[model samples]
Target: MVLNYIWIGFFVIAFIIALIKVIIGGDTEIFTAIMNSTFDSSKTAFEISLGLTGVLALWLGIMKIGENSGLINALARFLSPVLCRLFPDIPKGHPVLGSIFMNMSAN
Candidate 1:
């Protein structure tokens, strides 16, 4: 959590610096012009980030749904034999084998 806060601080500082540069470097007009253009690059960037986050959320939700639907269990069952063969030291029917298979399938 501390690391997360530190990262947030870094981003805030970076954003402040960029804003200051734009405002004080006689670049405010250029920035305003860019913002006025139909392209609106800054807005585009924000939209892209929003879309990416939404897509990530959708994927995570889908994965959770798949988990509840037993897709992961089926995959684990299907891969268990191959997993057991790959890790001979792990007993054939051990719970660890299923876990390993599940982790691999998740990845």
Candidate 2:
């Protein structure tokens, strides 16, 4: 998948940059610094996810309400025409058109 390539690319780029720093600048601590950066980045990502948990739950509840109230279906119907215009190849009144509207409403 694309995510696999992205992870591999990040590692490759980081390794190459660290190698260059060590070879050209004679920075013996480059690897240590690189490892520290990786740890810090992961820690930051975890902290951000933790912070977002409450917001995510709130949004999920709001989405449930919208779905139960028929607001999402109304939105999908309203957007269906626009989506058809944007994706003319999908054909008007197609099942995929409804799905596209649903996806947009969800977002």
Candidate 3:
């Protein structure tokens, strides 16, 4: 929620500054520049996501294979001692432990 306010504040500040520039400095193209930059940034972001698509797909595919072939379970069992120590509040065989292990494995 705090992040939302901060993001809104950023836009509000930019708009106020841009308005001042337009009124006092007679900079008519400020909003156009802002819009162009926004579009360019979004395009670049989309491109980055497109570039990562293959790698993301392969990673999820490998994880799925490991799950189906029991490698994930084997890994969880192998790391159970350390994980159990790290997460003392979680019961030994809790379902959440599997997800925790999977998330850790992703990292």
Best by TM-score: 3
List clash counts for every candidate, in order. 0, 0, 0
Tens digits of lDDT, candidate 3, 1-107: 99999999999999999999999999999999999999999999999999899899999999999888878777777788888999999887676776788899899
Per-candidate TM equals 0.43, 0.60, 0.79
Candidate 1 structure quality by residue, lDDT tens digits, 1-107: 99999989976776676588787895656545544653676688899999999987987787778677877667766777787678878865566654575567558
User: Which runs in model 2 stand beyond 4 Å of their true positions?
Assistant: 74-102
Cα misplacement distance, residue 86 of candidate 1 (Å): 5.4
Cα lDDT of candidate 1 equals 0.72
In candidate 2, the residue pairs with backbone N, CA or C atoms under 3 Å apart (3 or more residues apart, or in different chains) clash, namely none
- lDDT by candidate, in order shown: 0.72, 0.80, 0.89
**TM-score of predicted model 3?**
0.79
Which 10 consecutive positions of candidate 2 have the poorest summed lDDT? 93-102
Top of the candidates by lDDT = 3
